[model samples]
Target: MAPLVWLITGCSSGFGAQLVHSAVARGDKVIETGRNAATKLKHLEGTGAAIVDLDVSLPEADVKRIVDEAVKIYGKIDVLVNNAGYGINDDYRKLFNVNVFGALSVTRAVLPYMRAQQSGTIAFVGSMYAWWAPALLSVYGAAKGALRAIAESLAAEVAPFNIRAIDFEPGFFKTPLTDMAKIAQYAPTAQPVDAYAGHRAAMGGLAQALIGNERGDVKKGVELMVDVIRGEGSASGRKIPQRLPIGEDAVRVVEGTCKNALKVIDVWRDDVVGTTDRDGFEGEKDYEAIVKGPDAQV
Candidate 1:
């Protein structure tokens, strides 16, 4: 196969950085991008990967220009990894900008090229929070949830053109993104109320503990991601999962969420199933789920 070209966002640290290393190690051409790419990503100086400065939160035209420059490096882009995160500040607006809209803008820029080539993969680095977020960070989870929804619908729309949009929800991983100390340095000072102080403190303590002792390994998780993208190693002989949960904890949480949803649906099916246009439509007796199998996705 010809060398695949990868344009990845958020290469400054953590999973994004690890992904650049992983892809380059596999001999794929990589355009590693992030803010201050020449400085933050200096560690990759001699790795043969092109360092491209890309601030995903920038204007759409700026993003398009940077992506266009990246595409010129390899003449085409085979994969896009939308892994940028809220850097420095946890302001809710910036969180949505970097985590949600940033990816959308970048994806829109590359989509034309992918459609023309009739092949590509777009991976959105989401979080377990998409399923169930912890306290004090609901906004972050909301952004991830939105990204997941985009991927799910975009996959169906683009499949006919042989492009894939995937959303990867990883549990707490040993990445700078999960570093509570760094987050504290940038987090805004709290305006506390007497009644909520205890609750806020508890959530803060939980975050510090969980982030400090994150369970997922950065390199291993990124390697698995690369394998799936390349259709090698563990991903061989298997179709790439459109919504992949990165670690055991992520899988467990995702599974629990699904089971809980199914339980609610099963409990409410009879009450809610026949209410809407049941009489106007064909007799609902035979409206049972037509697809019945353990592996059924929908």
Candidate 2:
């Protein structure tokens, strides 16, 4: 097959950068963009990929301009990697702008082209928080959760058109982007009274360790993603879950979650669907209808 044309957002750093390298290594054509595309990914020149500036939250017209440029260059976009996003310091609004609204805008821009071509993949870079909610990141979690829902429903809507949607939820990866504290979006304020001291401490410990620690192998993650895109025989026009839970601790948590999910299903099987009808009178003679039949009269 001909080399796939990949349009990746937020190629400045982390997964996007890694993925660009991986794709280029495989001889794929990549149109990588970011908020500071001119700055973030300067080295992409020799990597057999192109770079451009893209702020996902910009106006619809601006996003359309990007779509136009991309289509002009590549003829058609084979894959749309919606990886340009960031947390905000302002709790809800800023996060919404970058993460949720911007993502939607970009997605909407390319959707027309994808549908027209009748073949494409849109991968939303979601977070594990979208599934397992954590403290202090409620707004960010909500944004990702919304994106996941969008991907899920959009899949059903676009399936007939042969457009695939994938929600790539990566657990904590070590990168400059992982420096949540300095990002202006995550500066913590004073705590409330009577907090669960132990739990709060534990959660904080986990957060720092996961976000701050340099553990994830970017190369490995990117390789897995490329595999997802190239792997033949995958369900066409459906969500390809490259839901990578990086790190050993994340692995344990995911495993335990899987186990618990199975146990809960087993325990609630009867309750969920019921084995039999309750011991109630089968006939109306036992308990007459609160509102009598029309023929029964006033």
Candidate 3:
């Protein structure tokens, strides 16, 4: 098979940087991009990966132009990793801009190229927060949730063209995004209510304690992603699912959330409304399964 061409965003550090290395190690071409690509991704220059300067939050025109230039480097982008993102506790406007809209803008630019090629994959680097919400992370969770919705819809939308979309939910990875210290930047801007001060302080203390102790491995996670994208290793012969969780903690959260929902539904079957007007609606609708289609079908 020809070497795949990968374009990944937010290559400054974390998953973005690790994915660049992983894809290159697989003998694939990569266009590593970040805010200041020349400087931030200097180390990847001689590794057979092209570096492109890109600020994902730039105006749509600028993002499209950058994508066009990156596309020229590899002639065609076989895979795109939407890995650039960050989380701010309170500066959610900026958070959504970079994490959500930025990803969308870049995805929009690349879709045209993918559609033209008629064979490509787009992987969204999402979060475990989407499955299991955490304290003080609602804003970030909302962004990831939106990503899941988009990824699922997109997977269905583009399957006919031999394109695939995968949304990966990674747990508390050892990325800078999990750094509790960064929260201090927004401290002055926080508007605290006296009623929840003590509880909020306790949560803050817990977060501070977990700063350097996160267990997720960025390299291993990226390796798994690359393997899945290439259908190699344990992923061999398996049709990649529309959504996946990267870390063990992420898997646990996704499972727990699902089990919890089932338990609630089972316990409150009577109160789950709309049952009274069954009106020949006999069985449960496996709508998600229908919408997702069989992996083999894709």
Each prediction's TM-score versus the true structure:
0.90, 0.77, 0.89
What would the per-residue lDDT of candidate 2 be over residues 1-298, giving only the tens digit for each residue?
A: 6788998888887788888998887788999988877776787767878777888878878888977887788788888888877763554776787788888888888888889999988888887677666676678889888887787667667779988776766666676666764553565454634566776688668767777566666777667667777663332343355344445545665677779988998999888754565677364563475335222101
Number of the top TM-score candidate: 1
Tens digits of per-residue lDDT for model 1 on 1-298?
A: 6789999999888998899889988989999998988788898878799999999999999999989878888899999999998743547898899899999999999999999999999999998889987766788889999988898878878989999878889997987766767777777665656786787799878876887688899999999999888889988877776688999999999999999999999999988876765455765355454333322232
> Model 2 lDDT vs. the true structure?
0.74
| Candidate 2, residue 86: how far the Cα is off, in Å | 1.2
Q: Residue 172 in candidate 3 has what lDDT?
A: 74
Steric clash pairs (candidate 3)? none
Candidate order by lDDT, decreasing, is: 1, 3, 2
Question: What TM-score number comes out for model 1?
Answer: 0.90
After best superposition, candidate 3 residue 130: deviation in angstroms?
A: 0.2
The lDDT per prediction is: 0.86, 0.74, 0.85
Collision count for each candidate, in order: 0, 2, 0
Model 2 Cα displacement at 280 (Å)? 14
Alpha carbon deviation, residue 103, candidate 2 (Å):
1.8
Model 1 misplaced stretches (Cα beyond 4 Å): 87-90, 193-195, 276-298
